[model samples]
Target: MLSIIVALLVNLLIETSVSFSVVVPGDPVVAHVGSTVILPCWINPPENAEALEIRWYRKEFSNTFLHYKPGKVPDMPVEPYRNRTSLTPRSDQSGGLKDGDVSLRLEKLRVQDEGSFRCYVSGESSYDSEEVDLKVTALGSTPVLFLKFLDDGRVNISCKSSGWHPKPSVTWMSDERRVLHPGGVFYSREAHEMFSVHSWTAVSRSDAQLVSCSLSLKTGELKDGRMDIQGIVSSDSSGPWKALFFTLFIFALLGFGLVGFFLYKCRPGKKPDKEIVGDVNIEEPRKHAVEITVDREHLHPDLMVTKNCKIMRDGPGYDHTGEGFPYELCAFGAQRFTSGRHYWEVKLTQENTPPKNYWLIGVVKHGNFTVRDRSALTPSSGYWFLCSDGPNGFHTNTDPPVKLSLTPRPERLGVLLDYEEGQLSFYNIKESKHLLTISTRFSGTVVPLFNPGAGDQSPLIILDCTKPVKSAEESSQPLLSNNSSNA
Candidate 1:
């Protein structure tokens, strides 16, 4: 009887000595925006955790990001994490909890997603928790330089870049390697918590030649852009004006000779059937081109915009409604138009293996526009869309919807809106063929809208058509109004 009691007591002691603890990564996990990363957390001894309750939450929040109660399904995660957070399986054949792996797989990481997360595991008799830190970074676009003439005979050089996380440092330098002190600096934070910066400096015309702008981060990522201002100034006190005059004289003689030849070709009976104007043979569409940039603040959470605001693509995770539109990947233009003619182009590519199955591009009114309902896309509802579906082909979003028959589908689409004329037209820029036109009276302000559609990896790019004019006469030529309102 004494030996039996002693053996039972030893067994009890063995059972009591079994330990329960949590293991987490010693270092913080670093991930880029629009990428997937794993936050590791697991039971130290590798026991079956399938029956244990597992909960993951942000260290600063009470709302759980993920919660699993043994045999029951997980509860809904917080808004920002919906459809973006999941648990990795410990093995291919068994559920993750069975092997004590509670690692969280987060997709389409955003700048605001950086922080510490707590993973809690609870069993019938033991409970343990661990904290893991995640850091998110975004590389910004290449810097761009803009030049403006100031009233004091100096030029204002502005350098701009977007889509950086934790901000970045910008510098201006002259061709002679002199560092410049920027007059002003500005920063804006996007909805994703990334940043955009603009810095400006005033320099004399002589010092403006070959100005360079550079943006850099602590991680050794750097981008540089340069602008040549020599052409902007005709001559400086130390420059050779006589040589410039001689060059102009030679060009003038050549221009006169070309004009004479053109006149000789059109002389009386020798006139050709088609008239030639300048170097172009065809009458191009009225040039009303505008530079379009995506509005980051209004972008869908599951959509990623390039630092330049020109390219937009569907993010990695499945789509879920945290706020605003529920099932669509949408972004708006940064500029809005209330009047006058405006035109912009979007380029699509077949480089994506299967190509994108669905896309929508057009304009939408500013107020009371709900992107929540895909069916509400119509002119009456303040939306004018030219949509394409893989199976359904192309169509316009009208009251009854109009099916479009287009041969050799367009890869580059040009949208022309004439607010005063009550006209909206679509064109295949590659073929220079007009596709469709809708006549509708628009009121108030309207901004460009873009949707790349779900499951499509292809990005929609806004093409920049603005270029520097060579002569003052060309620069002064009357073109479409370039004024725009903030989107």
Candidate 2:
């Protein structure tokens, strides 16, 4: 019993010899406007030292600081940090007595709390050595995507935030419950003391409606703006629709003016309006009419595609591909394009038979993304067709072959290719949308691309591609007609 008592006393003495350490205040940082914040901190030594008192401190001047004493408050501290501090002891977290987790916890944080902090501790030994420092910052106000008005009845929107230590990203969402990806504007400028971003996209297209702009940051998610307008507007209609559209147009234009003033006067850095990042140059015209040939191969009705340039699936939530092949990245190509006044066109086809499942087009951008339409071409007898329009201009797509009346290649004029069972498509110098399943009798998407009409923009890259196999021959026999069926 005597020996055991001696052993216990020695152990307690050794433990009491370790120095106290800090748990919070390591570096300066930022917190979103309304985030439940934690101030990380820990002290040194080992296990026995866990019971040490934890305190939080803030240095006012070089030598003066405001600190909190553990268990109970110390006599009286400086006026600045009197009632604004707290200490949380975490024995399980402290690196044993060798280290301590005497961190600070601050509630209902305010903007002024952005600065340097200290994790102080009190223990048995000499009340001793400490841990490290921490920095706190005032994050910017929640940035709200503002849907304001524009002149001429079009809609204009912008995103704004303030007080953020590091810049945040802003995105726009429409009533379609889709994200409007921003493509051109990735650069940002400093506003007052925080970061600010203003992107302009003229909303003028079919089936347009309500939208929301979302702001995200390292701090957290903060949505703060609302759509300020009379009502909804559809891009597919005219007239009375014109009234609401025009109203949004005028308001959006006005919003544009306000954003311009703020961008010019408040924003620190600026770039030329026309210097778009994805801008590629193309001016060469195709001299020899290129040919697309296909050969019937596999006996499966699935999609497969082959192209010259590598593809990039930029929009969020999309992964490249699978099985025998993977996507490779490369530079972009230029294809000729004539703005259809306001949108672009694409021809869609279904090689086998149209499935009950549906697909939509996602326009990739950095901040806001735009989805053209859910049903590009509806299933007709064996195909589907559509004419799509948006702020990006106009575009046409393939439809299930219509019954007489009248239905040309793509409403406009382009190359149309398909098979008897399914697989429909129309591609020009500028773009291509080959989404379909080839009849098992012909399972391969091998379209030998030919440079047509004008311009070199006929990029080697083909987008939204399904699994396609490469082919290089123009077969005429019905049994041998690969149909190149995969669009």
Candidate 3:
């Protein structure tokens, strides 16, 4: 009887030891937004957990997310995790519930999901709980570099990017890996709780031509952009000649204006014809026509781009493919404009398809083109667009969205980007009308934007705007200027 009692005591001690301890990953599990992850948790001795009560909670035991027990249906998870939570094996090697793998499988992970999760398991007489750390991250858009000529002859190079979670570190370095001192750094929290960062540094002509800016996250995701200051910096040497020519050209223009004004006055009551003036204003954008093609690398996965990258349409798949622009339903232009004027046109109507009633046309800072929501596409966020809501009306994403009444809806839209002049003008090419002009100080490289709204039957076609430019001798009259808006 003494030997049997001793054997029973040993068995109980072994069973208690096997069930009293829980094992979890020592390192924090890292996941990005919109992804799925498994927080590894299991019994130390690998005993079956099917009959044991399992609870996955955060912060404390009462704040449970998932609960399960033997011979009873599992209770509903908390509201935020209604259908996005589940139980699964820690990995392929895990033996699953039969062998005590009670890892929590989280789906559709969000920024708010970053924290500590407690994995608690209990039997009739023994229980164990362990904490697993989770880290959420979001890799934001590429950094965009903007160059501004400071009054003191140094060039102010600004770097900006958006949509990053857990603010990333910005680094400005020369091609030789030398660190640079930034003039200013600004960070703004977007509507979606992501971070947008902008930093600037001034460089002189004597500095190296290649300057690169990088944004890095703790999870090892990094984005970088570079700018060549050779062209801009070298132009400084010709400043005197450029100024002299500019002064002479201005005097010549004044002389011509005076002569034209006197000649018009001499021809008493000879007013300009409205038709001719309208035609000239409408054709002004064509003078700066440039060839533009869609950028496949920056395009949304839901968009099907042609081989030539000139046409784009919505694809059948609505789910993101984890490539290209993860959230934006738009495509970027391959051509980038840092200065001077440029114009391109997009065709909204395709043969055998319904006319496109919904579209978004505009320009965005190069490298800062990805956007998750329309509300974040404001000018302050480095987005300037004209949205057409399919029979609802036309609007601009200004501080307070401006609504415009457009008649005889445009089939082909012309976009004119006057970078140095700080103007973005839209035109109705078919109707020979100047639609609207948005004025804002443009910094950095800007790229054309196009969005064929979902459910639209037609695709957006980028036409080759390489038409011949008109010369001064061919002009019959000066172009009429459109009023500029704060947009």
Candidate 4:
């Protein structure tokens, strides 16, 4: 009976002294680049892990990613995983080292971090380990589409995007859902281990088609963009027929020149009874590009202007003094225009924000010409500007206020102030389309005005238009009065 009891007690001791196995997630842990992730790992049966040696490594046992022991200082991981790796409790388990949680906390995850990690733990008697798989992914930025008219009369559309991991797939499709063959696909890896993709396709211009390009990952991540390519062609993309017609017309002009000379020499001399005495004057719009900067003294308290005075945005939680442009988020340019034509441009998508919906961009009378509300912002009251009220639409601050219909809203707005002509014109610099013109008489100084309305994420940025650039098509067309409102 005594022997039997001793044997049973020894068996119990053996069972209690047995080693514990390391437990890790059965499925691969997924995380995105530039994010933090916890690779779950723990010891079964919950034992104090503080006294045990913990090591996390990649392929080789000698390659230590993270090492910890009770009395020894923590070992630094490999160069790649140096400061980014730390031992912490599993997300679901809060007991940490005391409760046997030995999870690895990785910060600023990189694409190279996607692999198998071995979590090894050792006690006085035995050691065990388990491997955890990590999968990293990155969703790229929005794809940008570029259109080019081929010499063969086909429209070539190209799509480009960057900052994606795992090599995304590209798909080209039409509005009818028919898949089109891409001309070529090219990809390059960036310094950060992310991929940039560029693909293009050529389509006939015979039919109008709405095309789309989609970038996708096997992880069900997608970024897509669409552009209407129907009848898409550059303004000067006329075929060879136009050149042939010009050649023939030049020959015809030469033949007419000879015949006119013959007639002048053969016909009798004749003189007009009255000599033309009136002078026909032709004037072209003069471009006087001036560098504009925000006047810090007159800036609204709620407005935040950059140090360069080029960018302005709303600053919330600002205390109003109830003086000087109260309740208005406005800033005036330091450069004033009393005469000549001054042109400047504002970028509506600065500071990584989306296209602005609410903004007021134009010129206001310099000096103490202050108005309380929209009603007071009129030419008669010395304020002439164009306003964008988001989905409510766009308008000008004329006497009665003229509403405007602008298609494909302007991303880069060009403002021209003809101080002598008393005309303020707005142009969509991206599309080269004239938006509107305000006609009024100017007397004193007028400064460039800007108001980034509330409820927008982007900052109003005034670009450096020291030398205003104008395309041939933009310069040839005259500003039409059909869209103008006389103030």
The candidate that wins on lDDT is 3
Sort by lDDT, top down from the best: 3, 4, 1, 2
Give one digit per residue, the lDDT tens place, for model 1 in 45-140: 888887788888976437688998976978888798999999896345545776788889998888888989998988877898889998887888
- Candidate 3, poorest ten consecutive residues by summed lDDT: 478-487
lDDT of 4 by residue, 105-148 (tens): 99999998899999999999878999999999999878878776
lDDT of 3 at 144: 81
1 against 3, candidate with superior TM-score: 3
Candidate 3 vs candidate 4, lDDT winner: 3
CA lDDT of 247 in candidate 3?
53
Winning candidate number (TM-score): 3
Preferred candidate (TM-score higher): 1 or 2: 1
For model 2, the stretches where C-alpha displacement exceeds 4 angstroms are 1-64, 67-75, 88-101, 122-155, 159-166, 173-199, 207-210, 219-231, 234-487
Model 3 agreement with the true structure over 1-487: per-residue lDDT tens digits: 9999999999998867654588999999999999999999999677789989999998878889899989999999988999999999988988899998999999999888999999999988789899999999999888888786778867889888888999999889988889998887778776446889888898886774899899999778899999998876776678888777545433322233444334435555666432211233656667788999877766676677666677676677666443332237878988989999999988777556656777889999887655676655768567787878776778888755667667677888889898997878777777776666676888888999988776667677777767543333112322211111110
Candidate 2 RMSD computed on C-alpha atoms after optimal superposition onto the true structure: 20.2
Tell me the whole-model lDDT of each prediction, alpha carbons only. 0.71, 0.35, 0.77, 0.75
In angstroms, how far off is 467's CA in candidate 2?
82
TM-scores for all candidates? 0.49, 0.33, 0.56, 0.49
